[model samples]
Target: MRNKPGIKLTKEKRAEMISAIKSYYSAEREEEIGDLAAGLLLDFIIEELAPEFYNQGVQDSYNFMEKQLEDLLAIQKQ
Candidate 1:
């Protein structure tokens, strides 16, 4: 993935994500991590993994629109 600027989240959203991360670690790993650690993990994910996911979503949307355009063209008068 290209080096892109860090993703920005609203304060509320960041808090929500940090909570989710903490919950995931508690439930899945049986470990308790603090807010700072959870926030760091969130930063790592956003910086390293989010671009690939974002690219896939963009590709999927493009493919869907392309198919829809093709279908629309098929109905045009000859």
Candidate 2:
């Protein structure tokens, strides 16, 4: 199968996520990571992990909308 393109982030948003990743490592793991490392980690996550999350979100929305459609049909006039 063909691979999808990696998710793209705005420069500002990418910087923000890099900072958050650094902070998480510092606070939760007690390890400090530099911007380059953090940025690479973020890239890996966007490429490797984000699709599963995106797919789950799509599935959730589909299920919710399907239920709503069923409810709408139940209320249709005969």
Candidate 3:
């Protein structure tokens, strides 16, 4: 059996991360603040955190992807 890595983060840590990300983008471009914040959080998880939390990577990806698709479809119907 393979040993899983422990990658735990608290809410404070996540908030700190989001703040650093906002600072970086704030220096780089004139992006919309809300979009930048959301994108930063998504990118941080996908790039930094998902591999440790998900033993089965594709399963996590598919689940979120499907939900996003369903949400989009619902919005289209409205």
Candidate 4:
């Protein structure tokens, strides 16, 4: 199947990109570590990578769970 307009990468390519980013984040850096890598990850996801079925199957579920926990915490706080 052809890639859609918004998404620039194939599913395998996206996974590889994400894996590389994650690995880079895990490594210790000379300068600011977590902040820079995290910002890059967020930007890449928001801009470059397009969601695929497999990506949705994994990432979306985790994001939903995280948001649910965050919401629950907010409710408890209130």
Candidate 5:
């Protein structure tokens, strides 16, 4: 998958995440995966799922700010 559009993690961070991915599979499923496989899995997940997660995060921020504003308005009225 050359030139696939995706966010790039720093090499160190990427290594750590790849390690985590391997660990997750080992711990959760009792299966050991290779570095290449884990890296590819990570790429697939970031490419496919990151946008939905990002949107959810944006929505969460909006909800939190709206609640905070409501509280501030109530205080201001007092």
Candidate 6:
């Protein structure tokens, strides 16, 4: 599997995520998944779902800057 540089998780964190995912499947779906399956699922989530989250973060930053600029303009108007 080609690793994604965009999503970097420490080894401990990676293991935690994989375990959590497996646990979620076991609890919610009543299905048992092994480490390999959990790892693949985590990879898929990072690759597919993370972009939407990243885009939202970018958009939020843009909006915050815009609000700050507006505040600065108001201060200048004073």
lDDT of each: 0.93, 0.92, 0.67, 0.62, 0.90, 0.92
Candidate 4 local Cα displacement, residue 53, angstroms:
28
Q: Residue 57: error of model 5 in Å?
A: 1.4
Question: What is residue 2's positional error in candidate 3, in angstroms?
Answer: 19
RMSD of 5: 2.5
Give lDDT tens digits, candidate 5, residues 1-78: 456666778999989999999999999999999999999998888888876898899999999999999988887754
Question: Which residue pairs clash in candidate 5?
Answer: none
Q: Which ten residues in a row have the lowest lDDT in candidate 6?
A: 1-10
Candidate that scores best on TM-score: 1
CA lDDT of 56 in candidate 2? 99
Query: Alpha carbon lDDT of residue 39, candidate 6?
Result: 97
Question: Which stretches of model 3 miss by more than 4 angstroms?
Answer: 1-6, 39-78
In candidate 3, what are the lDDT values of residues 31-73, reduced to their tens digit? Answer: 5466456555756675567776675777889999999999888
> What tens digits encode model 1's per-residue C-alpha lDDT throughout 28-62?
99999999999989988999988799999999999
Query: Which consecutive 10 residues in model 4 have the weakest lDDT in total?
Result: 28-37
CA deviation > 4 Å runs, candidate 1: 1-3
Ranking by lDDT: 1, 2, 6, 5, 3, 4
lDDT of 2 by residue, 11-72 (tens): 99999999999999999999999999999899889888899999999999999999999999
- Quality of model 5 by C-alpha lDDT: 0.90
Clashes of each: 0, 0, 0, 0, 0, 0
Query: Between the candidate structures 4 and 6, which one is better when assessed by TM-score?
Result: 6
Model 6 regions more than 4 Å off: 1-4
Each candidate: RMSD to true structure? 2.3, 2.5, 14.5, 12.8, 2.5, 1.7
